[model samples]
Target: MKPLVSATFLTLASGSIGAQAAEIGATFEKPCPFGDCSAGIAFTFLGETSIQTGFSEADVEFGGISGLDFDQATGRFVALSDDRAERGPARVYELDVDLSAQGLQGVSVRRHISLLDVGDIPFAPQSVDPEALRLGPEGFYWTSEGGGSSQLPPSVRVSFPDGKHLREFALPDGFAPTAEGSSGIHDNLAFESLTMLPSGDVLVALEAALQQDGPKPGLMLGSPARMVQFDVLSGKPKAQYVYMISPVPQAGVDGEKAMNGLSEMLALEDGRILTVERSFAEGAGNTIKIFMVDLSNATDVSHISSLARHEDLIVPARKTEVLDLNGIGLRPDNIEAMAIGRAGDGTEILLLAADNNFSARQKSQFFAFEIVQRLQ
Candidate 1:
């Protein structure tokens, strides 16, 4: 924990900035973990802060922030809650995250926008499980993992900034759950990651393997998860690739309880993506790892209905590990969201958020890092 400092307000001709700068009083730096560090970027741990549990605004309980996106034009962030309409209406919150040359200054909530259905009404309880979110050309694009037990299918939808329903994208038949458990996403493991590419396409990733793909990740064996890319205009899947999830980093007290999966992703300008893989064990806590995934040579498995049958016929996405939070000397929580932004000095920064599950023992933690690119 770091000492909290007073907030410094900044004003612009357009209006007053939403968040004020306050010092968190912590800093650290680590070089890239992979080969050729001189040609890669280093992560400078800036600072960290947390929102009090049970915090509320606009009548909505604020927690379960599973996805995030930075708004460069407005200098704000949109955080999506995976509440499933349990505490209140499913929603997204506008936040002002103060980042300065020194480090991450502070974070404040500005407003909450309730996501609506086709009739412009707020989603009913258990109807949708909103997860990953990203800013797109038309508006904000978000994902719903849906309820596997209740047989509610997963969805990717576009919503206006005000949270009004724009349209829902069509998904492939492979994503639909079946009563026999023969195919589709497993319970609570559907679309947990989403990103918009430079080509106006969007990609959504499953948190774990589908029933037909293989078994869930274990301490000794990894699983195969799917990443589907959709055409923004047609809302149709153009391609799908396999991203092999790592096995659980550590085993839990109960061997069957440990698990690992892909949680979030951010598309980069160089046709690569920054991926967040979160593994957790009941008593062992969490292990968060960052990887850069290159899909240039990945075989498109969209035409193949089942990856289990053609495991030897396809090429999975190539990935290179970048950062491991365990090695950074911080006890990470359930980190499920990631975003890229620029600090006041125009330096690229990386931000990560944890989903507390609204548990008293957990925390809504936020970590900031400066992306220091090294020269060759």
Candidate 2:
């Protein structure tokens, strides 16, 4: 946390989307995702410095909220609620797009997917995966985290409305898959970030596992994180890209609670790939970094550059932790989603969102930045 950024008590602004023009706007319900003490904030950026963020869940609307997704077609949003677990219950709601409406807009329950529906995954006590969400190139692609103690393989399976689900194959045996928690099941593998390739392949992020010192399960060291390209047609890994973020790209990055954030990955229309990471250093509450990658130039793992290091459009947080803008321990207050969009002005914009961790301590907020031509 870089010295609390001097925050302004929350407020509401009503305008005709004119002049001061909304640069970015987000929508989210309560039981925010970052912490347990703060309300969730959300935003959707319309490029050209137009941003809008609001607390639509509990505090502002229903008095509580959870995980959510937006439907551009419906011009509305949906959130997940719960009966209470490590995370919370998996409740869903419908959000009205007309924020300009004065009085409180009522929320309606639509879908309620709970942890009990979580099957056999051995990971966090929570069911909904915080952060790692994307309108996957595969259309309707979302991910979940496992570890902590999940016996089920930490996997990312695509669940379709018709009941058709497609999942990446889990590593066989005690091979120990990497990502979230560990159920001690040999085939336990956790997937964090994911992107669909031009070839119709899915590039999935895998955080390799760690072996303990004492009995087979004492302290875990970690392998490394890599982008495993999978040929969906074959349901197997076709290629792997090592990540410098981890010491053992094959295992996982070392010396951390876990190689925390491998947020989201996207292959741009021009062929360049952009990836997001949350390197929460001691007291760095939630430090989000973006890397612009050129697969053509990236012969190996050594080719990725920090978006912050270069001048080409680096987007840092306008807000860090919900509590102490300067403190770290703030569990999950980082940008988990990013998408490149073009505005009405013919300018390019980068949109980002923070995972509230469904905790009252954090807010479900979204942010936006312009990836300068230099970074592009």
Best by TM-score: 1
Error of 2 at 369 (Å): 2.7
* Per-residue lDDT of candidate 1, residues 1-376 (tens digit): 1111222222121111223332233222223423544435345566777896789888778899899998877777789998989899889888877777566777788898888988899888889999999998778899999756888889999998888999999989789998888998899999999999978899999998899899889888889999999999889999999999998889888664788999999986655788999998988899999887879899999988888887467899988777776655567799999998754445456889999998888878898875544444
Prediction 1 global C-alpha lDDT: 0.81
Q: Model 2, 1-376: lDDT tens per residue?
A: 1111122222222222333433233211122322422323222222221112333334322212323344444444543332224433333334332211121122233333332233433234454442233344343444444453534344555543322344545442322433442322222234556666677776666433222201111123323344656666665655555443322112223544423434556665444456665544333356544454545433333232222133343222111121111121112355555554432232333444455544555554544333322111
Tell me the spans in candidate 2 whose CA falls farther than 4 Å from its real position: 1-131, 136-139, 162-189, 207-223, 246-261, 282-284, 297-332, 341-349, 370-376
State every prediction's TM-score relative to the real structure.
Answer: 0.88, 0.51
For model 2, give the 10-residue run with minimal summed lDDT: 317-326
Give the Å error, residue 61, model 1. 1.2
